[model samples]
Target: MSFEWPWQYNFPPFFTLQPNVDTRQKQLAAWCSLALSYCRHHKLYTLDIMEAQESPVFNHKNIDRKLSMEAILIVFEELRKKGNLEWLDKNKTRCLVMWRRPEEWGKLIYQWVSKNGMVNTVFTLYELANGDDTESEEFHGLEDWMLIRSLQALQMDGKAEVISMDDGKGVKFF
Candidate 1:
């Protein structure tokens, strides 16, 4: 007797979690690629596990499979191991999707400062965050911590200096 297999039939076992490491690695890579693409396209800078609706990894409807927080953490941990993701907060709830690193951010800031003649100029942190002087396609609406860390990194390298003013609102960068 000969048996015929349906070429287009959906197999429930295909969705079942595989135990093999190689298969799991491939699955993770695909998922990460999709997640990263979605995040980048949406300009998403942070992901919150507690608030899962915004995350693409958890909002998929095709398979009726929702990723648990633990699963999401494991995948994020793997991405971190591969240097593709970074945790921005102490609780590990908010992550910085580091397609570019802090060093790169520092370099971009330095270039912008040089290009726009912002060096030797006195500006406040609030100004930097929402200033007309630094208004441009880049560095606009940049996060405070990321900007400070990038500036500090530049300062450590002797490329720039940060000066504090008496008003408690001004931080000059030169």
Candidate 2:
């Protein structure tokens, strides 16, 4: 037996907000999951609302189905409040999504260093980012600010020390 569509109707202008809390919660959860996964996969540390590409809101193809900037901001703000994201600047134009927080990055760096027998070896931050000796799969092309922040966190834990190079163009980690 084959099933056939019994009802063929187009409902236009159904301006009704969902009143069920459970349904709304489920919807919100789904949206959040998509947003976070997108951010993580793209390594989008920062998101700018004015910049349409950075924001998940705004759809160029479907103008009628676009999400308002205010709505997008609300979702980002909620994420920030929950400690999942942070504003990089005062204007709130850019946001840093904490898929993996600084503390976790610090631990990972420490583990990598210990595992690779680089605990006491002195190396520049740039070297860590693009070094042939280091794990190219992990730290290559990583954001400098993120790497520095992670190193600083490790420093606080006495896991590593950051020193300024003589040239002032780079930093050495020991």
Candidate 3:
């Protein structure tokens, strides 16, 4: 979806803890939907839970209101349980917001490899992410950690294998 804000976007109660159980549930749902849309629109793949209050959508400049860290943590926990975000650290402070899940990304890469006759080819992680040939790819310039996660997903399906080189890791699509 586009970046259209919901009618409840700027509603003051949207930022705080709700007393009623039903209201709180609805509020959490709204928060998650809003966050998903906003992050997708911005092509943001991660959400720093601790810094959310200072980030867009969470920080409301016009109303001078921001979600407290506690509120952010609560909503983030709900989002995590829904499989829309993954905790990056054991502390539950940083999250890898899965606007597009890593498994899907791995499939996309596999398709690209097949279409381009890259299967059975050994390519460094660097090449798959930043080579001139992949400049136009959707996952071009992807961060190394995220790229590895995607590759690991492929490995689970017997689609790829990783080779440790002196410089870095390489992937053999099969």
Candidate 4:
């Protein structure tokens, strides 16, 4: 799906950083919303800020706008502060975005598994994510890292167990 930026996004001045604190705050908030929406729309759970500097998100084709690294970092920093994203590396290079937190995702997973009588059944990570049995589920095609996080949330409640394997991974719901 394609995303259409709001009017402010097309405004030439919107590409430039505002000098005033109040204006900059508003711009930052707008940018945060845009980034969150884009990630959610694309099911994108991770973002590399440095990589984004050269991507279409930063480079607006029609307006010929691009964000400087300083601006990118500022926006990303704000996002981190708000808990919408968290740095994955010490250098703050990449982030795990939370359009939907692991806790919420865990609840969805539990519901899906219960509906399918998967509770107390052993399932390889591959089966849960890519098996034909799960193709119609919402959590199908979930990234392993994200799935592990979500299951970890469930694990806190004693609702799931994750077992490591030489080949892949396995999960048993309880």
For all predicted structures, in order, the TM-scores are 0.70, 0.71, 0.86, 0.88
True lDDT of residue 121, candidate 3 = 96
Residue 102 Cα positional deviation in candidate 2, in Å, after optimal superposition? 0.7
Ranking by TM-score: 4, 3, 2, 1
Q: Clashes per prediction?
A: 0, 0, 0, 0
TM-score of 1: 0.70
- What is candidate 2's CA lDDT for residue 24? 49
Q: Which is superior by TM-score, 3 or 4? A: 4
lDDT of 4 by residue, 1-174 (tens): 588777777887777889999999999988888888877777788888877787666667689888788898888889888888888899888888887778888999899899878799988878877889878777787778888889889999999998888988888899
- The local lDDT score (0 to 100) that residue 131 gets in candidate 3 is 95
**lDDT, model 2, position 167:** 67
Tens-place lDDT digits, model 2, residues 1-174? 332211110111111223586754554444455557666666666667678433433332332444456656666776787677888888877887776777887787777878877777776787877787664555565677777887889888877777875763343335
lDDT of 3: 0.86
Please identify which of the two predictions, 1 or 4, would achieve the higher TM-score against the true structure.
4
lDDT of 3 by residue, 95-158 (tens): 8887677898899889999999989999989899999988898888677877898999999999
Query: lDDT (CA) for every model shown?
Result: 0.64, 0.62, 0.86, 0.84
Best by lDDT: 3
Write the residue-wise lDDT of candidate 1 on 28-135 in tens digits: 665566566666555465677667544434544555545666667777887788787888778888787755566777788778777878787766767776778677
Report the CA-based lDDT of candidate 4 relative to the real structure.
Answer: 0.84
